[model samples]
Target: MTRDIRQAAAKANSPEYMSLWAGQGLRLANDQPAASTVKQTIDEASIFVQRFLTMRNS
Candidate 1:
């Protein structure tokens, strides 16, 4: 998921998505000994999916 974020960030220049990934990355960076990074990535991806759906619907 982190890789996905990196890939998306690398391919696109969306500040909102970038910020979301950055925030998730920061949270992951801060958590120690816990597998929170994956969860964070999942949450971030879910947000992206929802945004995409909203845009499509609109």
Candidate 2:
């Protein structure tokens, strides 16, 4: 049970995984205008940082 819980938490926290997910999101959002591109990049980067911090904390 403890191992299962840990696995769940790790899945929730993995930065590399999250970055891929966010990158996909950015790609989808790319159809929007240029002004939105900066926001999307920043949002994706923020997700990357959050994932990094989560991994670091673990």
Give the top-scoring candidate (lDDT). 1
lDDT of each: 0.72, 0.71
Q: For this target, which candidate reaches the highest TM-score against the unseen true structure?
A: 2
Off by over 4 Å in 1: 1-31
Candidate 2, residues 1-58, lDDT tens digits: the string is 3666656667889543232344455655436788788887899999999999999999
Per-residue lDDT over 1-58 for candidate 1, one digit per residue giving the tens place of the 0 to 100 score: 5777756876887554454534555654664455676777889999999999999999
Residue range with the least summed lDDT across 10 consecutive positions in model 1: 15-24
Q: Give the C-alpha miss distance for residue 1 in model 1, angstroms.
A: 33
